[model samples]
Target: MTHKIAVTSAFGVESVTKKELKNLGVRDPKAIDGSFVFDGTMRDVSRLNVFLRTGDRVHLVLKEFPARSFDELFDGVKSVPFSDYLPTDARIIVNGKSVKSTLYSLSDCQKIIKKAILSRLSEDKRTTYFPESGPTYEVLFSIRNDLVTLSLNTSGKGLHKRGYRDLVGDAPIKETLAAALVALSPIDAERPFVDPFCGSGTLLIEAATAAMHIAPGISRDFDFLHWNFFDKKLYEETIEEAKSGEKKQKLPFAGYDVDPSAIKLALRHAERAGIREYVHLQARDVKDLSHAKSHGCIVTNPPYGERLLTEREALELYKTFGDVCKRLDQWSINVITSAKGFERAFGKKADRNRKLFNANKECRFYQYDRL
Candidate 1:
C-alpha cells in the first residue's frame, strides 16, 4: 500500500533534504514548512530510514483531519485502525504539538489520543488490560490551523544521532547541520577539504562519508525495524544495497583543533564513524591553518563568542582566520558563526551568506570564493 511520508529537517535545510529525497527516487515531492511530503510504499519507508542524510526524522502519515475540539480530535484519532500498525502490548507514546488550534493543551491532546488508541486496541483484541511489554511505538500529533496530522515515527531517535561522537566541544554542530554545510560547500571527491576549527571532526567525517557515498543511517536502528508489519526482507536488502554503494577509497580530508583533547575525541569519533582512514586529525591552532594543496575548500564552524571564547577573543580569532584565508588563494572559505559583525572581523564582506540555526542559536553561514 502506498503511504504518505513526511521527512523533516531544520528550517533552513529544506533544499538539501528535498534534493536528497529526489535523488532517492521521490518524484516531485512537496514541502510545507520544514517537512517534505511524498507518497511511497513500505520499501520506500525502509529506504528513507536508512539513506536519508539531512533529514531529522521520517514519519509515515497515518491520518489527517480537521478537529477544532477535543471530541473531534479523539474521534479522528480513534477512527484510524490502530491494530493495523500497533500491537496490543505495544507501548504507545503520544507526542503532541499545537499551533493556532482550539485544542491548545498539549498534555490533554496526548492523553485523549492515547486513550483513543487504547480503546481501539482493546476493542480489536477483546480485552481491557494490556501488559505493555512489547516494543515501543511513538505517535506524533500536530495541530495547525485546526487541522490535525497523526503520524508514526519511523525514526525513533533523530537522524543526527549517527551513533558516533560520544563527546562534543563547547559549541559543537549537529551531524545533520554538518552534512548540510558540506552539501552547501564546494568540497567534492576531487578537491581537498579541511575544517580548521574542527570540533570532534563532525564536518570532516560528514564530508568524507558524503564523498564516499556512505549513507549516514546505514548502521543505525530505526523505529520501523521493530514494527510487526514492516517488511524485514526489504529492510535487510536496503542495508545490503547501501553497503554496496560505499566508496572504499580514502579522500583528502583533514581536521585540526586547538584543543588536543578535542583532536583525540575527533579521532575516536572518526574511528567510530568508520572513516578513520579517510580523515586526518591533529592538534593545531587556527592561526597555523594551511594546506599544501591549492584550490581546496575550508568549511568550518568557529567559536562565536557565545560559548567557548570571549567576544574580544572571538573577534581576534576571526581576524586571524581571515588573514590565514588570504594566504590560501583560489579556495572557497565557508564559515558558520553567531558572532555579530563577522564580515568586519573577517576583513571583508562575504560573497553570500545564508541564515541557519545551530541548536536554535540564530546564525549566518558566510561563503567566500577565491582570494
Candidate 2:
C-alpha cells in the first residue's frame, strides 16, 4: 500500500535534508516547512528510517482535513481505517497540538481523536474492550488555521539519538545539527577532520559516519518493526542492501577539549559509536590546536553564551583561535556559535554564513575558507 510520508527535520536545514532524500532515489521530493513529504511505499519508509542523517522522524501521514468544530474533528478522524494500520489490541497514544484554530484545547483534541480511533477500530474487531496487548501505535495530530493533519510515527525515537554518547558536557550539540554542519561543508573524506571544542565528540563521530558511508540507523529499532501491515522481510532485505553499501575502514578524524573529563567522555562515546581507535580524542587548549596535514578541515562548536563560558571570555577565545587558525592557510574553518559579534571578534569576515537553531537558541554557522 502507498502511504503519504513525511521526513521531518529541524529548522533551516531543509535543503540539506532534501538533497539526502533525493540521493536515496526519491523523485520530485518536496519540502514543506522543513519536512520532506512524498507518497511512497513501505520500502521507502523502511529505507528512509534506516539512512536519514539529518531527518528528525519518519511519519506516515494518515489524513488531513479542515475541522473547526469538535464534531467535524471526530468525524474526520473516524473516517480513517485505523484497523488497517493498527492491530486489534494495539496500544494507541495520541498527541495533539493546536495553533490558531477554533478548537484550541490540545487535551480535548487528543481525547476526541483517541475516542474516534477506538470507535473506528471497534467496528472491524467486533469488540468493545480492546486488551491493548499488541504493539504500539503513536498518533500525532496538528491543527493550524482550522486544518488538522494526522500522522503516525514510524521512527521510535528522534534520529539524533544515535544510541551513542552515554554522557555529555556542560554544553553539547545535537547529533542532527552536528551532521547538518558537516553536510554543509566541503571536506575530503580521506583528509584530516578536526573539532577543537569537542564537548562529547558528537561532531567528529557524525563526520566519520558521513565520510565512511555509514548508515545512521543501521542498528536502530523502528516503530514499524512491530506493525501488522509492515513487510518484515522487505525491511530485513533493505538493511542487508544498506549493509552492502557501507565503507568500513579506519576514519581520519580528531577531537580535542580543554577539559580532561570531557576528553574521557569523548573517548567512551567514540567507543560506543564504533570509532574508538580510528579517531583521535585528546585534552588540549584551543591555543595548542594544530595539525601537521594541509588541506584539512576544522568543524567545531566553540564555547558561547553563559553555559560554559562568559560572553567576554568567548569573544576572547574566538580572537585567539582566529590568530591560531591563520597559520593553517590551506584549511577550512567552520564555527557554529551564538556568540555576539563573532565575525568582528574573530578579526575576519566569514566567506558565507547560515542561520541555524541549536537548543532553541538562534545561532549562526560561520564558514571561513583558508584554502
Candidate 3:
C-alpha cells in the first residue's frame, strides 16, 4: 500500500528534494520544513532504509488531527488501528512534543497515547510486553494550536550513522551532511574525488557511496525492523537485490591527510564498509596534492582548530589550502569552513555560498567553479 512517508533531513539541508528522491529511486518528493514528504509502499520503505544516505530518518505519517485537549488527543490516538501495525505484546515507547497548545506536558501526552493503545489491545496492558522481534514503530505527535501531527519513526538511530564511520574524532561531519556536501558539490565521481584533510575520511566515503549507489544502511541496524509490520524476508531480499545490482567499478576516490593515524583509521573504515578496494587512502600533506589528471572535484572540511588544531594553525592551513586551490585551477573546489574571512583567505569570491550548521557552529559551504 502506498502511504505518506515523512523523511527527516539534516538542518539547513532542505535542498534535498525530488532530485535526491529520484536519485534514491523515489518518484517525486514534496519538500517541507527540514523534511521531504513522499509516498511509498512497505517495500519501498525497506528499500529506502537500504539506499538512502542523506536523510536523518524516514517515517510513516500515519495520522494528523485537531487535538485540543487530552480527550481529543486520546481519541486521535485510539482512532488509528494500532494493532494492525504493532503486535499486542510489542515493546513500545511513546515519544512526543507539544508546541503552542494546551497539551504542553510530554508526560501527559505519553499517558494519553498509552491509554489509547491499551484500550485498543484489551489484552491486559501488563501482559502485552513490548515485543523485541521486529521493526519498531516510532510515534511522533506534534501539537501546535488545535492541530496535531502524528508520525511514526521508520528510520531508526538517524541516517547520519551510515555504518562506515567506526572511528570518528572530534567534530566529524555527520554522514547526512557529508552526503549533502557531496550532492551539492560538482564532483563527478566518474573522474576523481579527493578530500585533502580527510579526517576519518567522511567526505571521501560519502562521495564514493553516493557515486556507486551503495545503500548507506547496509552496515547498520534500524529500529523499524522491530515492528510487527516488518518483513524480515522482504528486508533481506531488498538488501540482496541492491547488492546484486551493484556494479564493480574502479576506485576514482582518494583522500590525503598528514595524520598517519587518521589515514589508518580511514582505510580500516573503508575496508569495514566493504569498499576499501574502491577507495584509495594515503598519508600526505595538502600542499603536495596532485591532480588525478581527469576533471573531478575536491570537497573537504579543513581543520578549524576546534578539534584538530589551534586557531592560528587552522588559519595558516586555510591560507596555504587556498593557494593550492588557486594552483589546481582546473578543479571544482568545494570548501566548508567555520573560520572567519574565508573569502579573503581563499583569495576569491565564492560563486555560491550556503549557510549550514556543523556541530552547532554556523558554517558556510563555499563553491568555486574552475573555468
Candidate 4:
C-alpha cells in the first residue's frame, strides 16, 4: 500500500535530503520546511531508511488538517486508521511541537492526541485498557499556522546515531550534518579529503561512506523493522543491494586532531564503521598540518570558540588555517564554525558561505575554492 512519507532534515539541508530522495527514485518530492514529503510503498520506506544519509528520521505521514482547538486536534488524530498500522499490543507515544498555532500547549496536545489514539484503538479491540507490551510506535505532530500534521516515526533514534561512535569528543558534529556538509562540498573519489579537526572522525567517516556509496543505515536497525506492516524480505533485499554497491577501492582520506583522545576515538569509530583501513587518522595540530597532495578537498568542523576554545584562540586557529590555506593553493577549503568573524579572523573572504545549524548552534559553512 502506498503511504505518504516525510523525511526530516537539519534546518538548512532540506534540499540535500530532497536530492537524495529523488536519487532514490522518489518522484518530485515536496520540500516543506525542514522536511521532504513524498508518496511511497513499503519498499520505499525500507529503502529510504536504509539509504538516506543526511535525514534525521523517516516518518509515515498519517494526516494533515486544521486544528485550532483541542476538540479539533482530538478528532483529527482519531480519524486515522491506527489499527491498520499499529498492532493491538503496540505501545503508543505522542510527541508534538507547535509554531504560530492556536493549539499551542504542546503538553496538552500530546496528552489529547494520545487519548484520542487510545480511544480509537480501544474501541476496535473492544477493550478499555491496552496492554502495550509490544514494539513502540512514536507518533509525531507538528502544528504550523493552525494546521496539524501527524506522522509515525520510522526511525527510533535519530539517523545521526549510526551505531559506530562508541566515544565522542567535545563538540562533535552530528553525522547527518557531517554527511550534508560532505555532500555540499566538491569531494569525489579522485579528490583527496581531509578533516583537520576531526572530532571523533564523523566528517571523515561520512565522507568515506559517501565516496564509497555505502548506506549510512547499513549497520543499524530502524523502528520500522519491528512494525507489523513492514516487509522483512524487501528490507533484507535492500540491505543486500546496499552491501553489493559498496566500493572496494579505498579513497585518499585522512583526518587529524590535536587531541590524542579524539584521534583514538576516531580510530575506534572508523573500525566500527568497517572503514578503518580506508581512513588514516592522526594526532596533529591544525598549525602543523601539511599534505603532499596537490589538489584535494578539506571539509572540517573546526572549533567555534564556544565549547573547546576561547574567542582569541579560535581566531588564532582560523588565522593559522588561513595561513595553511595560502600554502595549499591547489586545495579547496570548507569549514563550519559558529565564529561570528570567521572571515575577518581567517584574513580572507569566503568564495561562498552557507548558514547551517550544528546541533542548535548557528554556524556558517565557509567555502574557499581552489586558489
For 15-63, candidate 3 gives per-residue lDDT tens digits of: 6644666776777688765678878887878878777767778888878
lDDT of 1: 0.90
- lDDT score, candidate 1, position 34: 74
lDDT minimum window of 10 residues, candidate 2? 27-36
Clash count for candidate 2 is 0
Cα deviation of 206, candidate 1, in Å = 0.6
> How would you encode candidate 2's per-residue C-alpha lDDT over 1-371 as one tens digit per residue?
78899999899788898899999878887787557799898999999988889999999999999999999999999999998888878989998688898999989999999999999999877889888898889999989899999999999788888888667676889998999999998775788889999988999989988887888888778889999899799799888987888776776789999999999998888888777888888999999877888778999999885687789999999988888888787889999999868998888999999999999989999998772
lDDT of 1 by residue, 1-371 (tens): 99999999897878998999999999888987579899999999889888888999999999999998888998999999999998888988999799998999999999999999998988897988878898889999999999999999999999999887777766789999999999999988878898999988899999999999888988888889999899799998999999999886778889999999889889999998899987779999999988888789999999999788899999999999999988897899999999987899989899999999998999999999876
Candidate 2's C-alpha runs over 4 A off are none
Location of the lowest summed lDDT over 10 successive residues in candidate 3: 123-132
Report every candidate's CA lDDT. Answer: 0.90, 0.88, 0.79, 0.90
Question: Can you write out model 4's per-residue Cα lDDT over 1-371, one digit (the tens) per residue?
Answer: 88999988888788888889889999978878778888998898889888999989999999999999999999999999898888878888889799998999999999999999988888877777678899999999999999999999998899988999877688889999999999999999877899999989999999998999889999898889999788799999999999999994677899999999999999999999999997789999888988888889999999889898899999999999888877788899999998998999888888999999988998999998875
**RMSD after Cα superposition, model 4:** 1.4
On a 0 to 100 scale, what is the lDDT of residue 93 in model 2? 90
